[model samples]
Target: MSDINISKLDAASADFDRKLQKLLAWNEADDRHIQQTVLDIIADVRTKGDKAVIDYTNRFDQRHISAAGELELPGEILKSAWESLPAEQAQALQIAAKRIRAYAERQKIESWQYTEVDGTLLGQKITPLDRAGLYVPGGKAAYPSSVLMNAVPAKVAGVGELIMVVPAPKGETNQLVLAAAYLAGVDRAFAVGGAQAIAALAYGTETIPAVAKIVGPGNIYVATAKKFVFGRVGIDMIAGPSEILIICDGGTNADWIAMDLFSQAEHDENAQAILISQDESFLKAVEQSIHKLLPQMERARIISASLSARGALIKVNNLNEAVDIANIIAPEHLELSVEDPEILGKNIRHAGAIFMGRYTAEVIGDYCAGPNHVLPTSGTARFSSPLGVYDFQKRSSLINCSQTGAETLGKTASLLARGESLTAHARSAEYRLKA
Candidate 1:
């Protein structure tokens, strides 16, 4: 507890913005080595296809495979994994999947067209991508929740196929992930990972089919690979460290707030957890609660490091000030732990996911809360959104001009084209113009 040192900040501080900037700043440097390595891997996969994926999987993941055929897990394997789970685990997975599916069902977009006054039709055609690739981090980092979050929404969007790639380091696989693939209706899965898996998905291999888009979280190498392959394939987003910002009115249990901070901090040393409050005494109480409860946490060391390095206990003038700061920070997870959260939530403009009221813990949103846990991080909530069914679906502008409408539109197009000095465009439109 003595070594646990979380920063304390006041909204009235003279250098508050500077201190906040220092705290929130995450250095995302593009290392030449990593980019070059990813490029080489992409080139290899592009040229050699399945052989490259096999070779990299064997070398990086400590596997011995004579053929790429062994890389893909059969549908029977996924089914068997789901069936082999204990009753309790299976029930929990099903519950979470059901809730996620139900939430996603409401987000499905429908194509619609409307006739204009001039007998012209204008609307949008909504269509789902043919295939989407999901990358799940393997080893100890494997998250069954990630599989459910990414796969369920894509399935709900009516994507033709959901392909999954998970790295099974040292030939070890997690049954929970496989079971999730089964429950979430993953069409195919491969036990290959890192930059190689991303390249294979983006460009296609003999064994693994190419996908239109890729989604899910990964390590730095995987993130870089996603960045490199963006134009070739659609990606969810370049995710950053997980974060949580809580606004409390000194009413909720100090212990609960402290534990909530620990929840995100325990994710990793770089993860951030911040608490904002109007009551100075409540801030002190929460700090004491953090000191008292952190020792009992399983990931105490990690939480301590994260809190000490990035965590903050902020004292604001009032709850409104707290929301102002939250909007500026644009945290991935924002909790309004106040008496009336709905009122405060109205003022909140930016947040990946908002947890309302004292009873709503941010952890619930990560699991079965019926909203996407795959949210934009690193202040991306200011513009980006949570991964949803809409991500898998695309919109194409629809335009059906009647003969009368064409004549009028073509004349305008001809005038505009000629003004831009494009003779071919002008002539093409002029040809359609009637007299």
Candidate 2:
């Protein structure tokens, strides 16, 4: 096997920032053709409802379903899938589900209010959506983890019903995914996928019900459909490629860091894996380890391609500089593989999820760890956050004003409304004031 070449940069170099930016750039240009195609699909689903969904599902997923009813999987099938799983697999799923549910339970928001001096009540009310859609990718890979991550949180937030849609290309379904759906307490499961499934979820079909919000990950078509139907129904953030940034102190095992980088790199050609360390010798050791390990990976070609395209091994002057670079990247997954990971983690303001300590592999968080693996990518961690129960629950401002409080608030509202030249708003507030 040949040596793998990865990008290397010195943080003290004059053009380090530019080089880093070039490496970090991920342009998700909206392909006009995809947008138009998704638009057509959405419009068709809206106009024809069940027929459009069935036709698209047949064409795209290569299925031969004659009726809309066939698209909806029987809940019994999910249970059977769960029951049929091997004892080991079933036990693993159960354990992961329990941990995820426990974490989500803590994230659930409760309604709270406080009384003011005038006995006016003011606070926020938290409510879950009536129904939510979870889109799990189905063609090449099966993501049972996606099922648990999206569904458990919604359930914890007290969402009334959770609907799941996974494409069954060639009329074949993954047992693990169905088992996960059953385990996660999905209210309904659909066998259709792609933009058609998204459209059906956004606008109710004869068999499928429209949901208040949609979550999960998908391909370009699914993402474009989500973007088109944003205002019509709430959606989780549009995700980018998976990413991992590891900051090492040149003390951890070189092979461990190499495998950690490969964990994200093997995701896809676009997935990124980077390492920042102060030890030049350690960086070389990791590079050697990459060459030694790449050949053994099942997806070696993919990992190699990803590392060549987006991966980096940087030499920083110190750990602080490493943290500074990490802040700029705001990666989806940041691993502090140093001795004092907590201290370094304290200064981290951005990053979707931080895995502290050498033993804390990012892969653990992807699976059984108590946090949601669905996270903001493409530098969005700077503002966005990981998928959690909070995403499933929404807040409404609560206000119950006493007569005196209304009079006092009315004066302020009247002035603000009048300043904006909204006579109706001004009069509406003035009407609530004491005569």
Candidate 3:
């Protein structure tokens, strides 16, 4: 009772719920405009093919390009860009790429068709896509990491061809990004981006070949395009703003937690970084840490806005209460930086990924760790999963019924089809069972 009394539990439950409904949430209306644009762009690209892509590139990119073939990013640019990366940046990219590739390779699954207990051979054949589109976002932030996170998995999953479409805004693609793409062993790289690039990938353009699936993070525009084109082509997930949730108690230091929160907040103004603490004193300390740390950051304005607007330093009744809040949030990244993080980590059911202990940082997982950084956001973690080698893979059910097995399965199928009032389905099953 004494501990709970000190927390911020005043008559603000309704207000908090309203804020929660607004923040830590995604807006459907915002995507409608983007969807319309993507649909029009997809239609234009489909009708005009390469010409439409080139025209959109020139119009949107402000480039002086005339033909779609001209929009095909030159190989020499990647070659020179790869050669020009500073030794340190180049080495860092290689190290991260290696780690991502190794992790993704491990996630690759093989097909398995096995005999069931009922004498029925039922299994799925895991196969890779014929081609996949990888969207690497370059606006607001340069995510060379996005390149490896999205493409390496496809490579490991044995996707036949991996094409990259990066929205190089202002007619620019960073050298480090190109280097990352090169090192990741991308099959094709194009300069066109945004909803337009998604259109080219979803529908074939003469210059840009179509892909069976698209993966990676992007702006809302890119996410909307992915959502609109899902039926025509597969997408990894509609990633929203970056999100991180940290749970702490009395034993943890506030400064480290505050810094971790800032890392995600700095990514964008809409990004969410939350700290759930059992101790009111601990929460205050973290607030101070945030104040102390904000002065030194280069992106302090963006971080401050995100924290004051959407970031939460929640004071819960106990560790269990903290865990409950975290489960509801289903944050993209979850960290347990308590005295016994491993013990507390077991309570978490819905998170894209979990980082345990004070020594483990979210940035570690973002860079060199053996897990994926591409994760579900905006509570999608409740049902979805992180981007993995499986995203680029396809599955085919293997069905080969022996004479006896066919008789049994055919009878069951006929019964189900008849129950569902599908005479054609029942007749097909009857034919299989016929003498």
Candidate 4:
């Protein structure tokens, strides 16, 4: 394979900030045409319901379904798919599901209340959504791991039901995805996808139930549809291309670091993979390894394009400088491949998920490592987080006041409301006050 020209940067460069911002920039701006198309699809689904979903599925996925009933996959089919998987695949799926579920269990929020001296009960009631929808990219691209990552969390959160939708283009369905869904406790599965599936999940077709929240990843159309349906139903996030930033201390194997960068770059042409190291020679060694390994990759072209477009290798003065750069970039996956990762991790202020130590490859976190692989991307990690059980739960403030407590709080409320010129609010508070 020819040498790949990944970007090289120095923290001490005179225009380092300018160059860094350029590398980190990703435009997720809405396209007017796509937005209009998604709006039209959503409107159609809302108006025609089952017929619209069926029509869209048939047209988009090349399926010849005569009825909406045919769109819903039977539970028995999912079970059979799980039963039919190869022993190795089945065991791997089980392991991954178990790990994901165990991690999700810890993230579950419970209802709690505390009584104050005035006999006023104030706390929070954590409740799961009634139902959630999971969208897995289907057809030629299969992601069984996505099923486990998304469904496991909602199930752990005690979401009443979990519905999944995947498009089977050309009447082709991925058995692994079906098997994973069955294992992950998906209550329902549908053979439909794209913006139409998002529409069905958001508005509820005759055959599909409206989900309280939607989670998982999808293509551009699906993402745009999610944006359009935000007010109608809760959404996990509008994810950007996969990203990984590795801060290494020149000690780990260069080949390992190269492969780690390859993992995210292989996701798509736009995916970003970056490495920052205080040792300049280590960065060169990884670059050499990248060239050596590129030819062996099945998705070499995609990886190469990704690395050329957005990937980088940076020279930092020290680990502290690396941490500073990492916070600014706020990548979806941050790897501290150093001797003392825990110490370095303490200074990290941003990142969707942090993979600590030389042995903790970011890929482990993608599957059986127990953390949700679905993460905020395009520097959004500064503000957002990974998909977890908390994403599936809703919190309601709990307030119960005794008569005396009400009287005491009412005076403050009445004064505040009256000052704000909300007469009805002030009057309501006055009614609760002792006469």
How well does each candidate superpose onto the true structure, as a TM-score? 0.99, 0.98, 0.92, 0.98
**C-alpha lDDT of residue 199 in model 4:** 93
Give model 3's TM-score versus the native structure.
0.92
- Look at candidate 4 and give me any clashing residue pairs: none
- lDDT tens readout by residue for model 2, 1-435: 234679999999999999999999999886999999999999999999999999998999889989988998899999999999999999999999999999999998899999999989999999999999999999789999999999999999989999999999999999999999999999999998999999999999889999999999999999999999999999999999999999999999999999999999999999999999999999999999999888889999999999999999999999999999999999999999999999999999999999999999999999999999999999999999999999999999999999999999999999999999999999999999878
Candidate 2 residue-wise lDDT at 279: 97
Q: Give the TM-score of candidate 4.
A: 0.98
lDDT of 4 at 371: 88
Q: Which lDDT value does model 1 have at 371?
A: 98
Cα deviation at 170, candidate 3, in Å, is 4.6
Assess each prediction's global lDDT (C-alpha) against the native.
0.95, 0.95, 0.81, 0.94
**Candidate 3 per-residue C-alpha lDDT over 265-380 given as tens digits, one digit per residue, 9 for 90 to 100:** 88877788888887878888888888888888898888877776678777676888788878989999999988898788888999999999988889998887868898999899
Q: Across residues 113-165, which tens digit of lDDT does each residue of candidate 4 receive?
A: 99999899999999989999999999889999999999999999999999999
| Model 1: CA > 4 A from native | none
| Count of steric clashes across candidates, in order | 0, 0, 0, 0
How accurate locally is residue 317 in candidate 2, as Cα lDDT from 0 to 100? 98
Task: Report the C-alpha displacement of residue 87, candidate 3, in angstroms.
Answer: 2.0
The TM-score of candidate 2 is 0.98
How does candidate 3 score on lDDT? 0.81
